[model samples]
Target: MTAGVETQASAKVSAPSASRVRVEAAAPRPNMGWIVPTLYILFLMLPIYWLVNMSFKTNTEITGTFSLWPQNPTLRNYIVIFTDPAWYSGYINSIIYVVMNTVISVAVALPAAYAFSRYRFLGDKHLFFWLLTNRMAPPAVFALPFFQLYSAFGLIDTHIAVALAHCLFNVPLAVWILEGFMSGVPKEIDETAYIDGYSFPRFFARIFVPLIASGIGVAAFFCFMFSWVELLIARTLTTTAAKPIAATMTRTVSASGMDWGVLAAAGVLTIIPGALVIYFVRNYIAKGFALGRV
Candidate 1:
């Protein structure tokens, strides 16, 4: 009887201790994971903060001193950008070409990527390398040839000219990214779709496309970014009517003087399309990198 009572007491004591231990173990620890990310975010945002601040200031304030914030904040810069047809037209032109470049790059790249991912043909490896080599070539090397080629084709100074020119680099990059993501998808899915009496085109359009949708988003974002920022080829391809925002920015700085306020405003405006694009694609970026297709 005495031993049984002692054993019960010991068991009761140990059970509470075990439960306490488990409760403690299940609790989250203080992590330093946020430290590096926080610092990196601050670093990236600082330049943007400065640009926005400077945009609000007058030319005198901007030239006079380097202030963290504008002393006398004004919307004149924005007003100028909105009111001027020339300034706004550049934005419109840029949008047209950038969208064209992105659509063409992704549309062409998707099939090429799918081919590379799914099949083995003669010299397929060589072809893939050749396509990627276009990206490796310096843009300067292609500028003169592109100019002459577009001139010959009567595509010079057109949005299509800029869009096609951008494809020289963007298409290669899009293909590579899409190929990586597509390769990660399981081949079983294709087989299953085939066994279910789905036609190749139907299966690819319905099943395969959705599986790698994240990859498509990522490729499109990169294509848009590259084509948007590229100035050399854009300038080379288009003269006035289809001139990109980058070339228009050059007009601000000439032999006479720089239009600081207008330039700042243009710079800020240039960032908007990219920012909105990234915002929309931000969720897919992680999955895109993971190449996680069902």
Candidate 2:
């Protein structure tokens, strides 16, 4: 009876200690990993914070002092932009071209990416390298050529001109991103579908497309960002009707003077669409990189 009691006592002691050790092992380490990212985020956000602060201040307050926060904030700057046809129209023009560019880049790149990933065609490597080379070429070199080309087609000063121009860079990038993701997927899945009597188009549409949906989202987001932010090409292509917000920003500096408040407000506004785009695709970005084609 005494030996049995001693054995029960030992069991209770060992169980608690094992449980404590397990709890300790499962506990997370102190998060020093976040320090760099936190600092980077702060660095990125500071300029945006300043711009937003400046947007709320009046012209006098902005010019008078360098303060982190406005003493007297005003909504007049935002009102000015929203009410004015010139200011609002610039946003509309920017949206039209950006959307058009994103759609064209994604659509064209998807097929090209599929071809590159799935097939071993003639001059495939040379063709891909050539396509990527377009992105490497200086935008300045193409400015004149783009103007001449669009002018010949009577598309100068139009959204289509800017969209087409953006595609010169974005399409290649989209194709590269998508091809990487597509290549990661197993060929066995494709073979299985073919053996199961599924046609190529139907199988691709139903099975392969869903697998790389994350990559598509990521590529689309990148296309939108590049097209939206591009200043030189958009400016060179569009004269008035489709003039981007980046070009509209130049209007703030004229012969008479510089409108700093309006400029700050416009700058703050430019960030909104990009921010929204990033937010929507943020989840896909992580997956895109993780599951990218081998």
Candidate 3:
């Protein structure tokens, strides 16, 4: 009798387990929502893939073929860019001005950002807005004035001229970005450092700067990208000696028509520096948004 009772009790327990297994199996699975984003990413990449495809083909093949890829892949387009002085110097000049602009913009913006975030002065709000207005003004508006000013100083056709001209836009953006990040840091940090006998400059350099390193990285990345790609000011401020790659690419067009393959190759090369910059600062960019400091 006891054995039969024990068997009945075991069966009761097993019944609930079997019912739960059935319930779980009957539950609805998540929908495949991921398909939309995957499709969108592929769509965005299609033009880039086409550009790369054209870069590897001869100009004649590019016009003649309807194929998705190069029919006869060749490196002659890239070879021309690397081996030619005019083509390669454009890249060197671009890098020089871009790096100079990024560094100068960031350095100047950092102190101004700190001032905006940490202190209040007369007309501070108006001053800040005025700075942003400079950024908002079209580069075309300043191109003539910049050319005339740089000409007066005998600074035309130099990398430094382009770097300084780009600063007119980039400095404001850097200040705006860095100011946002600096405001997120607590005022208590300043107080604590003062209590420990740290001077203002020393505290700011050693203590405050590290806290907002990610913000600086993000700001620098923006500065770098803007200066790298701004064709109008860079082109206007420079001629042959310091002409950027964007301006150099214009040479591909002639009375004979465009050299499609070489133009495509130049476009591909132009993407590399920006791509490398993004890769290096990607972590900082991700962190900046997460920390609400971007």
For each candidate in turn, the TM-score is: 0.86, 0.88, 0.87
Model 2, position 264, has a per-residue lDDT of 93
Q: Write the per-residue lDDT of candidate 2 for residues 165-189, one digit (tens) a residue.
A: 9999999999999998888788999
Clash pairs, candidate 1, are: none
Question: In model 3, which residue pairs have backbone atoms overlapping below 3 Å?
Answer: none
Candidate 1 global CA lDDT score? 0.88
Q: Which predicted model would earn the best lDDT?
A: 3
Cα TM-score of candidate 1 = 0.86
For residues 130-165, could you state the per-residue lDDT of candidate 3 as single tens digits? 999989999999999999999999999999999999
Each prediction's total of clashing residue pairs, residues at least 3 apart in sequence or on different chains, is: 0, 4, 0
**Each candidate's lDDT (Cα)?**
0.88, 0.88, 0.91
Worst 10 residues of 2 by lDDT: 18-27
Stretches > 4 Å off in candidate 2: 1-30, 254-256, 289-294
Question: What's the C-alpha lDDT at position 221 in model 1?
Answer: 87
Candidate 1 per-residue lDDT over residues 120-231, each given as its tens digit: 9999999999998999989899999999999999999899999999999999999999998889888999999999999999998999999888899999988998999999
